[model samples]
Target: MGLLIDGEWSTQWYDTKSTGGKFKRSAAAFRNWVTQDGSAGPSGEGGFEAESGRYHLYVSLACPWAHRTLIFRKLKDLTDHIDVTVVDAKMPDEHGWTIPEGADPVNNAETMWQVYVAAKSDYTGRVTVPVLWDKKRNTIVSNESAEIIRMFNSAFNDITGNTDDYYPEELHDEINEVNERVYHTVNNGVYKSGFATTQEAYDEAVTELFDSLEWLEDKLGKQKYLAGDQLTEADWRLFTTLVRFDPVYHGHFKCNIKRIADYPNISRLVHELVAVPNVKDTIDMDHIKTHYYWSHTSINPHRIVPKGPLIEF
Candidate 1:
């Protein structure tokens, strides 16, 4: 919930006052790309050549954005090619994101912010996860989850031999269309509702949130997946949000219009994805619950984690 100001750590929560209680997320600062031949793919500086055992991932299991990279790593068989280090689930005020016991593995920095500062001495913005660090360069390649997953999707195909493309060329137009809608209305909508400081903001967010959810319900009912018969990036992108909706977001984040369990298609979609080979192994309920309830003191001041959701997935 906090960020770095000129590389100095500040415990300030997101400022929703200026936006009239709207919680607008900050754009990811590091946007370097990792290509097969180190050529620039879309944005940022190049030379991040894709190599086995050269890149490491930093993520929080609780974070949906970070969860995207974890799933892509498993699905694309980059689990061994790129090593990962999970941050401590607890977000104590004194320690924003720490490695409780193990070594930093990547840069040997104790906290996540230190890792960010390692990238840039005076970096400012939210200290987010799903950071793709290049050990060879000794700097962060990218912290943007979408791009990180794209790298994981194809960059290491030569080594992993798992050429399962989630973002296919033909469906790019439709998938991006669905992604834009889902990112605003659903993936980030729940946070907007909970973190909002104004009634108007919450109302607008919740309305869009459920509307998109219902649209998805109808979409899934008709088609096998969001983009089509093939399960593309669109489906996995929506999944991390739905998987946490009931267990945490429903009650914790005030996204209480309806649970995923209420929608048959979504629930089936969740269970189906969870049943995938390594996808289930990526889910850690304890980390998800602890991070939300324990952190975000503005939302849950008492810092008491709840029990008894009893989710099947």
Candidate 2:
């Protein structure tokens, strides 16, 4: 919720006044990549080779984007190869993400802002999770979740010996198309709806969100997954958001026009995805519920988290 200003931490929320009450997310500051060789992968500089013990992943169990990287790591069988650290679930925007003092073994830094400070002394951006840190270089490889997951998909095939490709060659175009629509209308749409301060902005976001949901319901009704019958990265990208729909977004974020349970297709897919090996283990309901309800004091002033309406298949 807050961001670093010239390597200095500041407690601030997004000012929706300028955008007419619309929530606009800032782009991730770190964008380096880890390829099989020392060559550059896409954006940032090279020298980040695929090594088993050279990288460490920093994530929040509450964040959907961070969840995607966790799923990829588990699915690709990279758990033994990569080290990971999960931040505390009850993170507020004011102090930002932090672990207990002397808890983190990698950096032993309390706040995520300190991690950014380690990467760049004058860093200026929202300190988001799903940061892929190169332990050797002592800097973040990338904070962009999309790019991080892509790196996990193929970067360490040599070390892990799992060559299963989520982003396949035959389905690249279709995968990108599905990913684009889902990213905007469904993945980010919930935030746009919930974070809006004006009626017009909320209306626009909710309409698009449900419209995309209906489209997904129809699409999933026919195929076993998004991007045809084959499982792809597109499916996992949307899965994190859907799993959270009824539990968090429905009541907490004001995205209650319809729940995922209301749509039978999406609900079934949610169960199926959860049943996937290592996926259900990645989902932490306590983390998800606590972060959304307790952190957003604007929505739940008393911080009285509801106990009923249990999430089930």
Candidate 3:
């Protein structure tokens, strides 16, 4: 809800006035990667080798992006290799993402903004979660969830000996294609719809969101997963959003045209994924609902968290 300005914390919400009521998500500030051999990653400097007890992950159970990294960690058997710290569910405007004093063992920081400041003294960006911190280097390896999950997919194969490939070599083209559409239309589209300040913006975002959902419904009806038979990174990325659809996005975000249950294909897909080992344990419905309803005071002024609409998943 807020960002750091020149290493100083400033409380501010998304400014949609300049974009004509559209929500434009900013790019992540930290982009370094943690490789197996300490080589440079796609975008940032290297020297972050994959080693046990060398890295710590920071996440929020409410956030979909942060949830992806957690799923990957559990699936890849890296739970023993990497540690995590979950921030408090409610993100206040005055203090952003707060944890109890000394809750973060690595940095001993009270707030998430302090973690970003610790990485770079003059950092300036949104204090987002799923931050991969390198303990030895004393800096963040990556804050981009997409890249962080990719690193988890392969970086620690030798250490953990779990080489289950989600992003396979043969399915890269198809997975990337599917991820491109889902990222813009479904993954981020719901956010665009909920945060829009104008009628035009809301209409455009919701229409695209449902269109993509219908497309997914048709695609999933035929195949077992997003990219052919194998479950890939694309499926996990979209899973986080679908799991949250009925619980929060449907009513709170005004994406109520059709719930995930209405689309049988999508519903089946969610159930199957939930049944996956270590996957269901990653979901926390109470945290998911509390963050969206209580944090966005503009959407719900009373901060009343809903109690009904029992979601099976």
RMSD of each: 0.9, 1.0, 0.7
Residue-level lDDT tens digits of model 1 in 67-107: 99999999999988999989988887765887656667667
Native-to-model Cα distance after best TM-score fit, residue 45 in candidate 1, in Å: 0.8
* Cα lDDT, all candidates: 0.91, 0.90, 0.93
- Model 3 earns a TM-score of 0.99
Best lDDT among the predictions, by candidate number? 3
Off by over 4 Å in 1: none
Sort the candidates on TM-score, descending order: 3, 1, 2
Ordered from best to worst lDDT, the candidate numbers read 3, 1, 2
Model 3: C-alpha RMSD to truth? 0.7
What does the lDDT read for residue 242 in candidate 2? 90
For every model shown, what is its TM-score relative to the native structure? 0.98, 0.98, 0.99
List model 3 lDDT by residue over 262-284, tens digit each: 99999998999999998999999
Clashing pairs in 3: none
Off by over 4 Å in 3: none
- Candidate 2, residues 1-313, lDDT tens digits: the string is 6889999999888889999999888888888899999798779899999999899999999999999999999999999988888988877767889877776678889989999999999999899998999989999999999999999999999999999999999999999999999999899999999899999999999999999999999998998888998889999999999988888999998999998999988888889889989899999888888888888887787777777568864
